[model samples]
Target chain A: MSHATRRNILKTGIFFACCGVPHTRAALAWSMSADPLPVKQVADGVFAFAGAPAMMTRQNEGEICNVGFIIGDDSVAVIDSGGSVVEGKALIGAIRAKTDRPVRYLINTHMHPDHLFGNAAFKSSGATVVGHHNLPRALESRGTYYLQSYREAMGDDLMADIRIVPPTKLITDEEDLDIGNRKLTLRAWKAAHTDNDLSVFDHKTGVLFTGDLCFIDHLPTIDGSLLGWIAQLDILNGIKAKFAVPGHGAVPSPWPQALEAERRYFDVLASDIRRAIADGVPMTNAVKSAAQRERANWKLFDEYNQRNAIAAFAELEWE
Target chain B: MFATIQLRNPLVAVVLFAFFGSAISSSAWAQNADSPESTTWSSLKGDVFGQKFIEPANGIVSIEAPKRAEDAAIVPIDLHFKTDAASGRIKTVTLIVDENPSPVAAVFRFGVDAGVTHLATRLRVNAYSYVRAIAETEDGKLRMTETFVKASGGCSAPAMKNSDEALANLGKMKLRVFSSKSSGMEPMTRATEMQLMIRHPNNSGLQMDQVTRYYIPAHFIQGLIVSQGNRLIMSMEGGISISEDPNFRFEFDAKPGEDVKVEASDTEGKKFQDEWPLASSSL
Candidate 1:
């Protein structure tokens, strides 16, 4: 069965519980009412272009994320790991079936738990994990909390059984690794999606693992300073890649378009936060107002919608 | 025969056990305030650490913590002691975070724990009360002062994030060593300040999971040990208020070049250790 069909089957099975979230459940049931993990071959060498099956359509809903592969000579370098280790291992098993080529190098675009938490499975295979230097510290700082949350949220099986080992390697500004004659350039961007977000560029396939820095359909999560994130997007817009795999949502053709969409989200967030500040609303009310206006555009609006507005005002008005 | 029969009944046995458990924990702090065992500032005294805190009529230790804090989770406290004495005889200084539901937060012992007799650190104050500091004197008399801080409902401040995941990085330790600012003035004592950023939830277990309504069990850093190339750099005894992800900074007897390693463990049986090869970085 296809990945989206599987995830949708899994999500549909779990939707009854997810419906508990307020405001966006109906829309999610409408958009993702059917199969979501549709594995379309977007690029020449890539397969299984999966989209995120939103529990609720806040902003980043329709924007499904993809977990595809590039067949290398001796081994394979899977672009990004799915959200949880359960999903990660499933993809790894599928990849293992495709080619006996070692699932050699697992490249994480950033330090977000959704991307790096599954390192242990690959670690057992002795796959060398790589990311920017700050990724380890970021993961170290928040890793404990994420485990506790998962244990409590999903269940003990997912967290208790899995050991969270961080990326073994760290790169400062930029570095290149030869994966089967293909030179993949790992470039570090300034604090945008996070203090450390690294994009992996393939000279062979030209796939850029943009991480959370580039989201196609899903509303981008702004953990880094929004102003700083906008500037980083400008830098990302300059890079050349055939396809960009976002932290969440659809896999799209390179440069400027996905970057532009992300830049627009921040622009909207900034203007709204600015208006709230200009109206002399206190932080809480200002955030409330920002959320009401933003709910229409972004997915996951129920989850991080308020958080972004609150964080934006804190960075701009207070800081 | 009737009393023996009462003990054997399972329902009766459960009630009796419940009564004792509730009486032991509940009565310790939940009694009438007018009672003698009331957990107030006046309740604590004596050299709890068995150290000389202050000499009689020699100095003043004032607290520079917020009367009310921004984040009850992390409150900044500055302990500034008068250093007018020709010889600083502060054998030891202890912080008593009284009035918190958990009472004693944490304590710092100074041996190489030297300074102008002044120091600053942050802690989590779970409630409003007078935080007492007992400075033991070389002359064996302990002088005490108190600071009244208002912080309410902290032990329950939403376990920071999901717990099991946070525990994964529990023992991951970060050591940052730096140079002393008072290099020119203090020719006698060489002190370098080092900060230990430990990864721990330090959860007091008072928090509730919003969705499940279940109480989160307590998990905190019970012990933290720091050493500089085999030379002991004092171990810290921590409690609930060590704050989540516990950060500690203090002056220690170290030169510009000394390798410092920090080893720590949490209540959950997880250990994290890291070493910082000291550099000539400006403190």
Candidate 2:
């Protein structure tokens, strides 16, 4: 049997009950619904939805990340699925309202739960899942952990239908897919935002779906390599795209300009951490004030900045 | 009764045991707030210390961990040790993460005359748990101190950020020496601070394969010894709970010209050894 099918069976099997209660409620109290996420026409034949700048919860139905679709003459290609199956269904609803074209491809920008938990919702759409070549391995290591940990915040009801689905079509470097007359180019990147970051460039409209690579208002998280991300900035900027749809923040941001805030944040964090390392400061103490100067500029600064600093400090200490 | 339940259906019994553990940790501690007689500690004391009378840490030793871990996989834990006329000197210290799979994170033994004062390290906390430090002083008394940490959803935060890179540079070591900043340093042997970094994945092996779905076997550094010219400074018997690239920052008395050496061996039997010369007047 295929991996997805096997996992699907286990998800509903008797052993699942052995894992115990689905979840116990935490502090946050948000009433969530599975309404179709609102989307906007970012460019010609491109529609994107800007998710909330908050942690994924049942109230938001895990709609805390940008997910959208590109409509070609023959079919539609999705950029990412939201954080929950409910949000994923809402995304499909938004797609159906836009065009009657068949959903041919569901491209995951990365392996983060906010972007891929909705993969199960696209099963009936007959969309062949696509992602970075490293997506499967990354999912294998972290998929179970995501399922177990998110259950507490997302609750049992919303998490019931969530399943980890790996991509069938993997992007090694760059590959182009044709949907009628439109040519969409998919480029797989190194370890930056994640090890399996894949960005899609809609050739005809000049709209680049820079998934997680470019965070605008939301603070960029560092789960991959800090030095690798900094080294690839010039290469990411070299992509010739007029408009860009980031993984989070403004649905349709201006190209290259959208990269400024995150780049500066990384620079400030790296320099401060380097100074701390040079001064022989401990990781715990150094991360406390790594990027405190940028506190006023971004949303969810307190939620993710220190976490980013901790990861960056560990990575940069090897330098 | 416990053995009967285990024999009936090991899987179900295991699940129920885990369920009750979490429930006890969540509810009992929530209401009482780190009572000395909590069920987890009550039962753990017998299993670890074997009915010995344990005393509260009235300033003999202290543990500091983040109240809320930002990243669960690398929660920083700092331990400070003090020796007075009453409690002579600390000989060994055991670190435990109450709610982790392998609760006994590490057993660290210190040299009798090392005069180690402060030790800092990192750990992987799996749930909302209590991180405890049990110190065995020269008088053979057990003194314990613990801190409650609120961390959840760490499963997404795998210890290994770049797994391939972590494997590629396995066994790499770096030793950094910091200038002593504290007063009251022994005139003959000045107090010194040093940080040791080792590159290893320290994988928990709880992750399942994408294809076969079988869990990857646990692999981690099992033993570590740090010495200054044959006089042992510290040694650790560690488990999977240690974070990837195990990092340790510590302060101890230095004999000036002796070479500091580190020897570590992992589960795979791969041994790593490195040494650095200590300057005669290391500030």
Candidate 3:
């Protein structure tokens, strides 16, 4: 067998032998039912679950975004929680199967519901939730609405224990977190995908967790400033990282190259909106036809492209 | 608190019916005749109009809105008014989104001889509801037209995208005058189109501050008046249902070389005013 498995088995045996107590039946049953989510070890000691590109529905249990955890010498740091508490529990189970380290931090990349809905699952672990400084305000504005609105799509069962858990630790600009020997650099970005966009970089493994900042396969949504997102493309391309865990795409993708498709889509969307604004086309008409050429290239293009166009039209009209 | 009460209160329900009647008749109302769709409007009609007879629009006024809202926060509404001596000139038009916390989005009054023909603006639709335009003509007749708009669900709420950015440029205004392009217009019937955009969050006050546990008080442009060289063009009494960065576009007969002046005030008692020299019609 593998060395880590053998070591874990030995550690379990020692705990039972020394303490004279085994896991209770209920605890065992709970662990069995909450099977760990299938994850791939992209880098050494770093595991990620690449979510399917689909809407958050009851069938999928809201597992529609990338979520993962990193194991360090002393403790573990979860990059994002999932779209629902059930997914969050499965992630916790995955971390347990890998190591018996304490979870020190639960880092959220932004305030989007799909990225941070599983926050309540980390509450029992007492992991200090960390997010961008503006996250609290964003949540305060939309958290209740999110909880009420997602009920119909996600069902009552999956949302039962979900809570809008704001981060206790807020990163204003840049902060260094040491999860044992590993040092993670967290940076707060200006309004891009959303006002509270934050990114996490692991120094040891060179994995960057770009919450919703970078989208692939799925069309890039523009809930924030279109110009701001376009303006930051060069800087985001220059971010030093070997691999990136996009908010909604293949996890641990090769950095810089991972940002290519979204960059082009943003450029195309911006130029179309700019041209429409210059031509005196009303926002309603301009949004319907913006970026139609890129429709075939991305998932959920029809569902989101028009919405992005609406936001882009509003932003570009000021120019 | 206001939103919850609005749903159950008969007064608001009556106010919503005028708009909802045009929207629900096609989908939800057909399946169940006894649904709230019927009662909500029947009960609400009296409260809004109050003993005044309302009639369906017969080419007097018409409205255009997306069948399904692409973005709930910024649904566009288009309105057109026909000028005829029999129907008389429309003096006032009330825009309402039935399901919003406040059903009356805005009440727009046109100038006596302004000859305003077309108006367009954006709104924040809180739910699937009927968007209606009720026009009061000078001949003492009320003409109404409405359309249903399905709310764009999932992650898209009727909230500000960037609150900080919105606040940073609050009260800033921009006015753009579209040059007349259609050559078929008669000299006396030619109307110049101008779009006025204001930068404001137009906060709905539904959002609660977690730390303080109190609702963020509503802050929106409550009043606006646009005039050309001391001649009134249009005035509006707005509400929170209006989208952030309130925008209005209208086509009206213009007197060449007149300066267009706009004055507005918000709920917070802040007044903002600006004037632009109207471009000569020859351009």
Candidate number achieving the greatest TM-score relative to the actual structure: 3
Error of 1 at A146 (Å): 0.7
A171-277 in candidate 2: lDDT tens per residue?
A: 99999999889999999988898888999999999999999999988888888788888888889899999989999889789988888888899999999999999
Model 3 agreement with the true structure over B1-283: per-residue lDDT tens digits: 1111223455534434433444344222322211334244455567788888889987688999876677778998999998688888999999988767787899999999898999999999866677889999988989888787766755887889888899999999999988788886654567888899999999988777757989889999999999999889999999998999999999999887889999999999999999999766542
Error of 1 at A82 (Å): 2.1
Which residue runs does candidate 2 get wrong by more than 4 Å? A1-35, B1-29, B32-38, B152-156, B182-187, B210-213
lDDT of 1 by residue, B1-283 (tens): 1111223344543443343333233222322211213244333443254433434433466666655443345555666565444434555566777645566666555544434344555576643345666665454556666666543211112224223334656666655544454556553356666556666768777654433767656889887777777766656677886666676656656644567777777777877777777754543
Question: Which numbered prediction scores highest in lDDT against the true structure?
Answer: 3
Sort order, DockQ high to low: 3, 2, 1
lDDT of 1 by residue, A97-149 (tens): 34556767787777555565556656555678777776665555445545442
Docking class of 2: acceptable
Chain B TM-score for all candidates, comma-separated:
0.67, 0.85, 0.85
lDDT (10s digit) by residue, model 2, range B10-31: 4543443444354344221333
On lDDT, who's better, 1 or 3? 3
Docking class of 3: acceptable
Model 1, residue A10: distance off in Å is 7.7
